[model samples]
Target: MPEGWDGTTRDPDEVLYEISMKEDQMLYEEFVQRLEFNKKKVAGEVKCHKYSRRRPDDGWNYMVEKLGAQAKHGVGGGWKFISLPDGSSRPLNDMEKMR
Candidate 1:
């Protein structure tokens, strides 16, 4: 990271401020969608499973986030399933994969 790396100012503090603002903006947008996605999950229309073929365990993330797969994204949470590289199959809470 560089001082004023945001490419607008020379003040280092300003750079941090700019970053915070940008993150806040994105967070607001995501928060709105969280409500929307949660509704679908509650409606029994989605399931929480790992969706990323590259990163199965998905780390610590909000449930109403890009979900285990396409239509299932942003609506599944709390479920413990890892997306497998096979593209169609997955193992449920396979802790070994977390490695």
Candidate 2:
């Protein structure tokens, strides 16, 4: 009885069902897109961490060597690694000194 409904038109229930199905399909597609985006974002973060220059490892031996060479010629601050009570060590930067 609606404006576009004619006497020969399909059942109203069937039309409503079809519209609901299309809406569900669209929502599913959007969910998939968002999932893929999150996957790519996580992958990019992993890649950046893997290639970052300041990543800590092996008791900061690499950092010590690199900073040592720079300090040997009096070029920068005497940055050193400090071991915490929790058994983890990190480089003592200027910001830490302020704290």
Candidate 3:
């Protein structure tokens, strides 16, 4: 129950805009629930993007394209995990006795 939950006769567009903003601020789990709730509440009118781990960066790329924004970079400028670590690093997926 936030400040603006009085259920007044405000503009529907304004309400939808606020709801969209709040949905964007929600966490991953909460976002999923909110999307489901909104989809049912709005009768499939509200649009959203659902991403899965299998397609990690596709949604990000789509957002960047839609919003006309530059891609984000990590501290090491998009380097892989092994590249971030110093010294001789072995693939965590590759497990074998170092002869």
Q: Specify the highest-TM-score model's number.
A: 2
Tens-place lDDT digits, model 2, residues 1-99: 778766686889999999999999999999987787778853454244555577455434323323554365335545656665556667767865454
- Model 1 ranges off by over 4 Å: 1-9, 41-99
Candidate lDDT values, in order: 0.57, 0.64, 0.49
Question: Alpha carbon lDDT of residue 77, candidate 3?
Answer: 28
> Which model, 1 or 2, shows the larger TM-score?
2
TM-score of 1: 0.31
TM of each candidate vs. truth: 0.31, 0.36, 0.20
- Sorting all predicted structures by TM-score, with the top scorer first, yields 2, 1, 3
TM-score of 3: 0.20
Candidate 1 lDDT score relative to the true structure: 0.57
lDDT value for model 3: 0.49
Error of 3 at 33 (Å): 16
A best-first ranking of the candidates according to their lDDT comes to 2, 1, 3
The residue-level lDDT of candidate 1 at 67 comes to 39
**Candidate 3 lDDT for residue 28:** 69
